[model samples]
Target chain A: MREITYREALREALFEEMRRDDRVFLMGEEVGHYDGAYKVSQGLLAEFGERRVIDTPIAEAGFAGIGIGAAMTGLRPIVEFMSWNFSFVAFDQIISNASKTYSMSGGKIKVPIVFRGPNGAAAQVAAQHSHTVEAFYAHIPGLWVANPSTPRDAKGLLKAAIRMDDPVVFLEGETLYNLKGEVPDASEDEIIPFGKARIAREGKDCTLIAWGAPFHTALAVADRLAKEAGIECDVIDPRTLRPIDETAILESVAKTNRCVIVHETWPYGGPGAEMVDLIQREAFDYLDAPVLRVGSLDVPMPYAKNLESLVLPTPERIETAIRRVTYREER
Target chain B: MSEVKVERWLDDYREMLLIRRFEEESARAYAQGKIGGFLHLYIGQESIAVAAATTIEKGDLVFQTYRDHGTALALGMTPEAAMAELFGKDTGCSRGLGGSMHYFDVENGFYGGWGIVGGHLALAAGAAFRSKYLGEDQVTLCFFGEGATNIGGFHEAMSLAGLWKLPAVFICENNQYAMGTPLSRTSPLSDLSVKAAGYGMVGDRFEGYDVDVVREHLKKAIDRARSGEGPSFLEIETYRFRGHSMSDPGKYRTAEELEERKKKDPILLILGKLRDAGVDEAKIEAIEDEVEERIEAALKHADEAPFPEESLLYETVTVEKF
Candidate 1:
């Protein structure tokens, strides 16, 4: 195993997949020459050449639709949005064209494309540039939404997203691009399957669920709770939100007898709300407390540093929810 | 007349007549409540799609807007499949999932019957991108109404097609209106093809009433695309004899205006051309009779076809759902 940055992991996945299949090409605003806005596609233009590494003008809807169209005709395109915030302009292409084309054409058309980029808040980027779009995309039936929390998962999940015969929305963590984690060597070819949850930290006291940037927060909070309050939490990260690993969450909840979902998305009708409903409905009788959720405040992300920090689900809020669910008192 | 000219005229006339009669029966089916949802017929604009079909090769792809029955029929979709799709039967081209507005037959190089006005143009550019990337000579034909030309997707698609030098021919079938809004009210310029200059693409505009003229113009564009000369914008001036959809009464235009446009009907124009080429009266009448019989058979097949099974509802959402 070798430690690599999440950004490096993603680039490796793209490089490997494009090499494996000639049909695979990367197209986006700054993917080529610019080496991607986040530099995730650095050196891709030189390695894959201009034909495979395509650069387009600042037109999200156009390129997104083009990716869907290319997928329909037998090309596997990895269309990158500068950020998930920009995907709204291309929402129709992703929702209407990519998602529905497969079923609309009665399986005659297969949109084997991946729309990937950083999602959720990154520092003080404000409301428009910082959007956690997993809920909106996951709500669509024909789409797969994968939120990778680590460098290893980023590489494995991205590879799987590209190879799968369906449309995938790969939500990367803007803040986690440089996060270092262990990834298998190139010859290993590790690919993670969807609909599976990774128990980041195992415990029996309470089930603490989160994903993306929030997953790292949950892990840190779980470690702190065990040391300071003796509240050992079963920290879980269900990477893919759409075909969620219900069995893992319910199984952990059935043992722990309580749960608290933490996420960077808004509280109102978000993935956290869906998780709460699922946990309460499936594991209701086993619960000692109501399944609670700690999510971003139900308001537009603020521009000020202090207000922006408060709007997102901070470690303090997640710790409070864990204590409440576990019935542990403050120190 | 030369035997080759007569044969070409007869073939073109039969294809145009088939589309006209198919659309006419679709209107009847809509009125009878057999076909639910919006039915946008291509009654007077048959020559554009038929001519396009004649101009492209087997590997060339075609994309069209919601008013796509004509394109589907012209691209060799069986009458039964198109009619059954409108009727919402399991035997339909899209297997009852896609109604009239989403007819698809990929095997025949017809990608789809996209409902969104200009949303599909970018997809067409993408298809052309794939061809260019693979070094294939396949040309992509994207058809849309003049209404679609005003949308953002239209500009974005055109800009990309032009910038990338994609093998795409953007055919704007300016049938005078975007739904009920006339071109005079919607667009500033009467010649929509002039918009191509902004994207650095060549432009052409011609009457769509004559099948031969439509074919020749489309062939020129298609040939340029095949030769890697980049995309072209083609404004095929035509008129829809029917309203925008079945629900439209078309009171926006006067009865006299409608009659005046009908005088240049594409089907009639092709029929007259066939007669002038010395095609026998018996041959023309037999073609008309055959088209009539085909429509009747399609209607019967659609009427008898079964609705999709309930299990099919859960299928095709993804290739393999987790």
Candidate 2:
């Protein structure tokens, strides 16, 4: 297995998919000569030419709808949003056209398009540019929401999303683009199926579940809990949100008898809330304590580094929640 | 002027008549509570749809706003399917899922109707992009009210169509009002074609009531698109005889204004042209009888059509297989 950066893995996935299928093309603002706003599409224009790797104006709604239309008429377009925060401008197109066309047209139309970009808070980037949209999109029935945390999952899930015969909202972690990890040198046919959970770390004392960037925080917290207090944990990353890997999550919860769901999104109606509800309903009788949730504060992200750090799901906060769930002594 | 063949002119006349009668029946159905949701009648604007449908070939796609029955009918969707869709029956074009606001007959190149004002314009441009990307000689006709021209999406879509030289004809049906908001109140300019100048595409305006004029101009625009020249913008000056939807009483306009606009009704204009071309009263009567019979058959079929099975409710939400 060769190690690669998450950004490079994404670029490879785009390159391989576009080469495999002529119907696959990329379009967004600055995707051509500019490579990409984040360089995820670097060198794509030179490889695929200007026709397939299109550079659009600063119009999300226009380009998104164009992608849907192209998909309807035999084209698999990969539309980049620069950031999920900017996806608001094109939300109507995603919800109305891309998501609903398959059902609205009575199965006559399928919008096989991918809307991908960086998501969640990045460093000091304030409220407007920082948003975790997995829950927002997962709420929609016709869309498949992919929140990939690692370089391996990012490449595999993106390739699957491009080939899937439905609209996919690929929410990549903004801070994880440069993170290095082992990405298999598999052929174009390799794809990590959706609705499968990956156990990042295995233990029996308690379950610490997270996805996207927060998965790293959960892992760090688990390591600290073990090293400092002799607490072992099961860290699970549910790769896809819509068709969630409920079996893996519930099995872990049932085994550990306690769970602490972690995420960087807001606390109210966030990914953690959905996981908590499922755990309480299915794994309630096996629980030693209530299923706890760890998420950002119930407010918009702040620009100040101190306030932003306070708002996000840090390792210390996750560790505190894990100890509380395991009934360990306070530090 | 080119001589309008009697048979082709009659076909257009009958097609327009079919739309008029179908909408009138739809209004009747709405009144009786047989149809639910927003029922937008294409009563007065029949000629634009007829001309647009007759001009474009089978491969060219058509996208329009909520007032889409006329376009669907003109594009050769069976009257039964359209009526059943309004009736929310399984036999409907959308299998009863899309109702009146959304109708799709993709096989015949009708991408569907959207209830959102200017949202479909971008989607239409996308379809046009597909044609250009694949090197297919197909054109797309997108219809929206003048009010939609004021929306931000309209600018985004039109700009991209111009920038990319997509094969799409952006037709603005300046039907005077958009859901009670007059074009004068919302639009910066009464002449919507001027907006096209900003996008660098050829802009034109015409009397929408005259089917011949609509056909002639639309043919040229469609030809231009198929020939890889680029998109064209047209503001078809028309009026909606009915209120915006079944709920509106249209009290904003005076009875006098309504009467004056009706005097130049598109159906009547086509009829007058046919009579002037020596189409005898017997021929007119025969066409009316045939249209009436078709409407009756559609109505009866729609009335008897079954409600979609409950099992189908969950289907079509996504592809059945990978």
Candidate 3:
């Protein structure tokens, strides 16, 4: 198995899926000749040709909804948004049509489409551009949301998402693009199903569940606390957020009796709140203390370096939250 | 499909009667609070659907905007199933999920009766694209109003269809006003079909009230499409039979103007032709009675049909593995 970056893996996943299925194509602002604004679609024009890798005009709502129509008629299209913030322009298409097509048609239509790109903050890319929308998308019932942190998970999960008969919002953290990981060379027929969480690290003192870019922050903090503070926190990456790995989460919570959820979104209505609520109901009696959450501050993310750093969840913030949840005061 | 035979005149009358009676019954049902949500009647535009449908084959697909009862009735979506749907019954097509304005009947080649303006244009083009991809000799006809011609989706759909050389036809029913706004205010070029020419498409415009003209234009376009020629844009210039969707004042155009158009009414014209062609009184009476029987049976079926099971609200929110 060779090492690859998260963004590269995402590109490979798209190429492989398109290579395998002629019906799969790409439609977005710069998905064609410009090779994607983020370079994720680099060198794809030569591989798939222009017909499959379409460079659409900046008409987000029009093209996005058209993509939905195309998907219904047997084209599996992957639509790229420059950033998740721009998805608001195409929000009607994704929420009203793409997500609800199958259900509204009473399961008569299957929209095998993916609306994916760097979701969450794109570092230094302030207020208007820096936004995390997993909570907003996950709240919609028909859509499946997947936020993968590692290169391997990005590829595996993306391939799985493309093959799904439902619409998917595959989120990539702008900050985790360069993170390297081993992508297993699976057989041509391998299919990784949804709702399965991967154990990033094993421990017993407490359980820490994190996802997207913040999962790496949680990992860094977990290792630090284990070595210096004698806190062996088990780190779990709940890859697909919608159909969560409830079993693994509750089992870990039941064993450790403590849980700390970390996410990059603001604390109010962040995706972590749902996890905290769910874990409390399932593993409430087993808990030694209330669940602690590490999230960005509940304020619009500022543009300035210091203010931005203060608002975001960092490794230190996660480590502190874990200490609070585990009742090990950092004295 | 080749040209429609003269015998299909009876079939056209039957369909025209169904659309008229269905809309009339729908208005009564709405007043009685039996049907909820938006309802658009095709009272004045009966001939538009009947005339256009003569050119469509079983393999070709059709899509329409919110005012769709006439098209559905013409295409053989049994009024029983359609009426049951308007009542939100389980037996309705789409299982009561799509009421009145949102009818979806795949079996009858009806993609849907969408509420969103200009939404079906691209879907129809996509259907045409699929037919081409599958190497099928069929076409897709999308029906939208003059108001949507300037919308971005209209341009995008027309551009894509033209660029791809897809076998599709766009019917722009220029029915004067878009809800409350006049077509003059909504579009600079009130002639919406010619807008297709900018995208390298051939457009034909005509009076939608004349069934023969509408039938002639639709037949030529469908024939061109099936013979591997590209899409054609047909602008059927027309007027709404009623105030747009039962909620408008009759002040958009004067009664004199409405009377002038009514004088050229295709349904009346067809009946006149039947009489002139020696169709006797007994045959005409028999056709009318047959339509009445079918309508009464449909109304009975709708009334007898139960409301959709309440549990359906909690279902179909998420797609499942087959």
As a whole number from 0 to 100, the lDDT of residue B139 in candidate 2 is 97
**Which order, best to worst by DockQ?**
1, 2, 3
**Residue-level lDDT tens digits of model 3 in A79-196:** 8888889888778678877777676565677788899989888668789898988988988888998999889889998999898878999999988888898887645534566789
- In candidate 2, which residue pairs get closer than 3 Å at backbone N, Cα or C atoms, i.e. clash? none
Q: DockQ for all models, in order?
A: 0.85, 0.71, 0.43
lDDT of 3 at A102: 71
Error of 2 at B97 (Å): 0.4
Ranking by TM-score: 1, 2, 3
In model 1, the clashing pairs are: none
Which prediction has the highest TM-score against the true structure? 1
lDDT of 1 at B129: 91
Candidates sorted on lDDT, descending: 1, 2, 3
Give each model's whole-structure lDDT. Answer: 0.92, 0.91, 0.82
Better structure of 1 and 3 per TM-score: 1
Query: Can you write out model 2's per-residue Cα lDDT over B277-301, one digit (the tens) per residue?
Result: 8878898889999999999999999
Better model by DockQ: candidate 1 vs candidate 3? 1
